[model samples]
Target: MDHPPRIYCYRCRKPDLLCICADVTPVPTRFGIVILQHPQESRRTISTARIVSLSLTGARLFVGLDFAGCTALHSHLAAAPGPVYLVYPERGALDVVDVMAREHGWPDGAPTFVIIDGTWAQARKIKNQNPCLDRFERVSLSPGAPSRYRIRRQPRGHYLSTVEASVLLLSRLEGSEEAFRPLLEVFDRMIDRQLSFKSGESRRGVRRPAPRPEGG
Candidate 1:
């Protein structure tokens, strides 16, 4: 059987041999990020967890629908020392006000952060299955600007992808909103590539859109 000549992933707009994904390294931060990703989200070609984990050295990524105590995530959580803050949206459950209040009351030290990397529904499941997480305070973001991530759109304006949420948390903890600028820039570039690939695939047979300018 003649298979169509293997489309080079770069040409096909998929992950190429030299794709940036392979070289992703973690960055250091005051808060450690433990991302529990849903298995489905892990398999996605456009997984944002990959982006965030790669960009942050202090970050660890785990993939699963539920944490069953036997999973690697259990070990990680068991080893975590600081207070864990769950990054989720929904005002009453966990919000900035709650964390800020705790931070003020604490006699010493900051908290460790646990961010769930999946759809809002999947994240809630993660929280429910991992009873240990309940011991930690849940964290919700302050109302903010719209998400820059285009591939997966959140129904609620306040909801953010895992990477965005992590970046926000780091920014607040480090006392410099600008610290996360590099992470966001890297994310923006990745999103742009995904968008470009989709556009090309959508118009495979139609007149090609003008290529982006050389500098971009």
Candidate 2:
């Protein structure tokens, strides 16, 4: 039998009751963000890329796998008032610390980060397909703690959700923790809300197993 279509919140794109849109004060950062999401990631209700888009002031999320010649995506980069950087590579990319030390424009919020959101395999495919993204200066993070996202299984303990990664990257690059607190607050709420909902469903004896989501 076909399941009834779930009613969704148009803004956050979550099921209406599961929406985490309350008290979301868009976090403003010195730098900008652009998320190139895999089409598959866009289908996951638990995906945090939407959270980054809704909770960040100057961030944008575009859903696709390849965007090498995407007119809009490339045009936005060209029009950016500052530089752009891609985030990836387990190694060899410039460390976030080094970029702060070496890049003069970054201090003035002149660098926008472009992140690819998807499963590890999917993110790899997206990057390989997009030459426009590969050509940018890539940046990597040194995780201080394990990922806080418990519901999803990460390929590694240090893999962070999209919002978490954005929060860490911007907070470090801009040199302020307090400025990005609201984003984390919202992230916690979403995780808590989902946890509660799932537990409640179990208590009610909904036997269907939940599908595992990929790390953002």
Candidate with maximal TM-score: 2
Best by lDDT: 2
Query: Per-residue alpha-carbon lDDT of model 2 for 1-216, expressed as tens digits?
Result: 446677999888888768988848877776879999999888877888988899888788898886866888888888777778898965679988888878776454478889999999999999888877766898987789988787888899878888889989988887887888888888788888889988997898767646678582
**lDDT (10s digit) by residue, model 1, range 20-76:** 554345567756688888886775556677667777776787777656655676776
Q: What is the C-alpha lDDT of each candidate?
A: 0.68, 0.84
Clash tally for model 1: 4
Model 2 whole-model lDDT (C-alpha atoms): 0.84
What is the model-wide C-alpha lDDT for candidate 1? 0.68
Pairs that collide in candidate 2 are: none
